[model samples]
Target: MTKRTALVSGAGIAGVTLAYWLTRGGWQTTLVERAGDLRSSGNPVDVRGPALSVAERMGILPELRAVATHAKAIRVLDSTGRSVARIPMSSRNGDIEVLRGDLARVLWSAGRDDAELLLDDTITDLRQDPDGADVTFERAAPRRFDLVVGADGLHSTVRRIVFGPEREFSEYLGLYVATVQLGGAPAEPDEVVLLNVPGRLLALHPARGEAGAAFIFRHPEIPGLERGDAGRQKQVITASYQGIGWRVPELLDRLEAADDLYFDAVSRISLDSWSRGRVVLLGDAASCVSLLGDGSTLAMAGADRLAAALAETPADLGAALRRYESGHRRLTGPKHRHIHRAAGLLVPASRFGLAARNNIARYVLGR
Candidate 1:
């Protein structure tokens, strides 16, 4: 029997994983990424619960474990760089966390033998028919696929092309995060230090083995800041905690010198259903709970579910899409809101909220 063709958008963890599994299931897989090549960012990520099961199935669990960050346990602190509370992560069961770069590499390397990866290209225009969808790429000729999946992430182009404008479903979770990598090494031992102030949280996470440094700062909201301009986004974030304390001054100096920075308003993607006809969504493109723990894991789990569904029902694309959406959404949808609410308390709207949170941590949540 002739195999069906599947097209996946975005190259981040979700898209690539889907392409990987679809290939194994005897389907022709093509992944188109907007970026010229694999970014392989070194952001820290975790693989928890059944996510490990999927990795095991992918046969890369051993390699992923080898590259796991074994990040130092999380430390919560006060404004003056003083430790206030701590969470022992080693206590969690069956949890494996690794840098985002490692996972991306693992997924990419795993799929290299089975899937067709299209880098430096994008699906700029799409048209669907009763039999299939016709996609026009920015760099390639038009093509038809039995199905299209959006693994493009929160600002999913596939979602926009198939669903609608992004703003309709993505609600800002009342905070923004500015993350950057500094080139110069600090003259001190690297550690994760979190310092909280009213309506903001500043954190310094030293990169593994002194490769570089990572800084994260959070604020409730920035009303008029232009989100599209990268330079301006960096400026607004730097101004948010202009005089935070201790190493902050030196850190900002390093940030200005740094060229590559990652910044985004912490937000979640909410959709009633991931499928609209033959086109479906996955990962952050479907339900992004930005920067929250386990969200990406959920994305990976969704990829496995999606590929399995397609494998089981390749002859009927409609049945396959419905099955994938039903099973996967049941597991992931509600968690989106839970993450949003928790983030709100983590970085409150005012001084009162901040104090209340610290008090709760010191009294109620403390062990």
Candidate 2:
């Protein structure tokens, strides 16, 4: 039998995991990432449900636990910096939450030796036939592979090249967020301080030897901020969160010099199907629940599942791709349906909504 070859785009949790599993399953895997190097700046993400099993199976659960973000409680405050409530985080919870960068590093460390990694490059075009896909990269020579997987993320380059425009599949949740690395800690080591003013939420949590400040606010549409312009993004964030009270001004003051900034609108990707012929989509590239939901967990589990499906039918590649999509839809469809409701709770639409959320939180705390 001929050896199988695969090109996995994006060195994120999903892409790395997929490449790892594929290589272990006796297939040649090449991983490509547009970023010059692995990203070390991101919010802490939860590892639960199937993702926990995947991590344990891969032998990284212990490492993840060692570096877990011990955020014991979330201290919520009113607009005036008054303590409204404190929601205790479950220490013995079935899940583990670790910084995204830590998790990415662990996954990459585990797979880098096995898979070929191409950094600072991306696929510009993909032409697929009955046999394989001829992929064209922006900075590398075009290569033919038995399969092409797009784990690039919500705004996936592979998706745009193969599927139609992004706007056609994007579902915005009317919220925008800007998370920047804080120069110094704003709260206790194991605590997350949060302040809300109507539709906006400002939070600071400790991770990666520093603190990260995240600003989530209600935005009806995409802002006028240009892509890749951190200055314009900072201005938009400042304008959007101008009168949010609390320690926001201080945080914005810190944002001016912060280089690691992640800003985007909360959105979901709903694709009728995640694959076209020999090319397939994985993780956020296929179905993303965005910043407000447990997308990282889904991405990890989805990659493992996709890899398993491919391994089951290495000869019949198309059949394997179909099986993966069928199974993935069953897993992610329900989450996509109700993910917006979760986002609504994260960034309430109005003052009344915010009050209702606080009342609900208070009630829960009383219980």
Candidate 3:
């Protein structure tokens, strides 16, 4: 019998893990990524719950633990740079916190040999029929696959082509987040130092022998802000954080010179359906819960579930896709509903709210 063929877009956590599991399930999987190589820069992400089991099943859990950040505490500071609260980090059932890049690299190393990897290429158009989907790429010739999965990201090209425009599915959460690598190590190597004002937050997270700075602030959606225009993004960030204190001026100066900065609105994706014909969406492309959501964890677990569903009914692609969507929604739906609560906790909207959060941290959580 001929094996099933699958095409997965995006080489992030979801894409790579799906490719690995699909190959092991006796499918021919082609993983396509726009980048020339795996991306090595992103904020720290968690790999816990079902994702941990997924990693163990793939035999990469040990490497993930080896590269874990192991942050000891969260040190909160006021605008004056005075430490207001210190919340100790506690592991929940052996959960590990690793840099997003490190987790991606580890997953890629484990899965790279299992599937055909197409680098520096992306899907330009997708046309699906009852039997298979015909895909056109930027650099590669058109090909047909029994299944096509869009695990791209929040602003997924595949999602745009297959579903519709991004704005229709995306819900802007009144906040934006940016992260950049700093030039020096953190003052406290084992702690995450965060400075919070009313509607903004600046954090220095120490990881992998260095520190990365994160800026998150509440703002209305900026009109005409394109993803490729870093200069404009920097300008907006500078404007939002202007006159802010506690190492922000220095950080903004660094941002002006930093070329590896990652910036995007902290938004969530909500879709009525995750599949259209033979094309299916996974991870952030389908339902993104943004920062507070265990996006990485859900991505890994969702991919595992998707691959298993496909294997269960290889001859019935529609049933498999439906099963994947139904099962995965159970994992992501609650996070989507409760995202506002988490956002308020992370970035309070008013000075009163900020003070309340700090007091809760110092008293309730700090203990």
TM-score leader: 3
Model 3: lDDT to the true structure: 0.90
Ranking by lDDT: 3, 2, 1
Model 3 agreement with the true structure over 167-277: per-residue lDDT tens digits: 899998888998999867777899988899988999889987688889899988885463759999999889988988778898899999999988888888999999999
Q: After superposing candidate 3, which stretches have Cα over 4 Å from the reference?
A: 224-228
The candidate that achieves the highest lDDT relative to the unseen native structure: 3
Backbone Cα, N, C clashes tallied per candidate: 0, 0, 0
lDDT of 2 by residue, 1-367 (tens): 7778999999998899898899999889999999999975578888888888999899988898898886878877778987777888885546888888888999888778999999999999899889889999999999999889999987899999999888899887777778887866546787787788777888888764578888888766754442548888888788888976767788899898887788876778988888889889999989887564377888888998899998898778778888888987877888888877786677777789888887777677622
Q: What TM-scores do the predictions have?
A: 0.92, 0.95, 0.97
lDDT of each: 0.76, 0.83, 0.90
The stretch of ten residues in a row with the least summed lDDT in candidate 1 is: 183-192
CA shift of 122, model 2, Å: 1.0
Model 3 CA lDDT for position 277: 92
